[model samples]
Target: MGLLSQVLLLPFAPVRGSAWVIRQVMREAERIYYDPATIRAELASLEEQLESGEISEEEFDRREDELLERLEAAAGVQQGGGGFG
Candidate 1:
């Protein structure tokens, strides 16, 4: 079973408001809150800006890597066991 499925099977796992419970459980996944769409858009804009000489290539690459790292960190935080709370 998947991790989520296993978690749901726990004896005290709340079911009635399970969505809220899960959201609360994952809330500290990260402080950065850019949605996937927004992140993609921002990355595209950064790329275009760099190509157009509006921003330095170094700046573009740095910010892009930082955003990607944030995304990875958030994913890790979410996948982590109920250890954040």
Candidate 2:
């Protein structure tokens, strides 16, 4: 953009900057949410809760399935495939 174009766009600079920040935050959030280490730690904690009777067998089974699903998803994303061609 030329000087005049930049000057015209200056009025919208805050909106553009805010959008970029939001995108970056979402990317970081996704990275953390599917992190393997974080998932492993949570799985261990879940097991502890189950062994201590903090969670019933049914609930534990349900949560275990969810965690396993997340683990598989993270692996799939890392491998660039989800059992699909």
Candidate 3:
């Protein structure tokens, strides 16, 4: 496109990226803090994929546990008032 259009799009790129990041964060917050079954189901599917040779067991377990731990920690932090200042 035009140079002006490209320049304008440059600043908006980060905003768009930030919005996508926020969406993901919100979904994670909901899964970890409100509805945990989403995490469990995703983990189960990951484990199944690993069992079927779609992914390595080490990677699968590592990612699954990491997600679980992150969610649990987020839940704990929420209970702790989220360190608001």
Candidate 4:
């Protein structure tokens, strides 16, 4: 590319930089969200809530299922090297 092209595109540099930062943030968020340790911590917390009656059995079961699915997916990713949903 010529210097003229770089000069012309300089106006959009901030926009492009912002977009890249957003993508990186999203990827990191996804990584943490699907992390096995994070999911296990949540499961433990959910159990604690149930024990303390902070959540009902029905609610615990519902949320437990959701968390278990996330764990299964994370395990699959670890084993088969897949991407997060």
Give the distance in Å from residue 70's predicted Cα in candidate 3 to where it truly belongs.
2.5
* Model 1: per-residue Cα lDDT over 1-83, one tens digit each: 79998787875556646877777757645233534455677788988999899999789989999878766665676577333
Give the TM-score comparing model 3 with the true structure, all chains together: 0.47
Clashing pairs in 3: none
Error of 1 at 58 (Å): 0.9
| Candidate 3 local distance difference test against the native | 0.75
- TM-score (all chains, Cα) for each model: 0.48, 0.86, 0.47, 0.90
Clashes (N, CA, C under 3 Å) per candidate: 0, 0, 0, 0
- The true-versus-predicted C-alpha distance at residue 8 of model 1, in Å, is 42
lDDT of 4 by residue, 1-85 (tens): 7999999999999999999999888888989988999999999999999999999999999999999999888888889877653
C-alpha lDDT of candidate 4 relative to the true structure: 0.92
What RMSD value applies to candidate 1?
10.6
Ranking of models by lDDT: 4, 2, 3, 1
Q: Which of 1 and 3 is the better model by TM-score?
A: 1
Candidates sorted by TM-score, descending order? 4, 2, 1, 3
Pairs that collide in candidate 2 are: none
- C-alpha RMSD values across all candidates: 10.6, 3.8, 8.6, 1.6
RMSD of 2: 3.8
lDDT of 2 by residue, 1-85 (tens): 8999999999999999999999888888878878889889999999999999999999989998998898888998889853321
Q: Which model, 3 or 4, shows the larger lDDT?
A: 4
Off by over 4 Å in 1: 1-32, 78-85
Q: What is each predicted model's overall lDDT from 0 to 1?
A: 0.70, 0.87, 0.75, 0.92
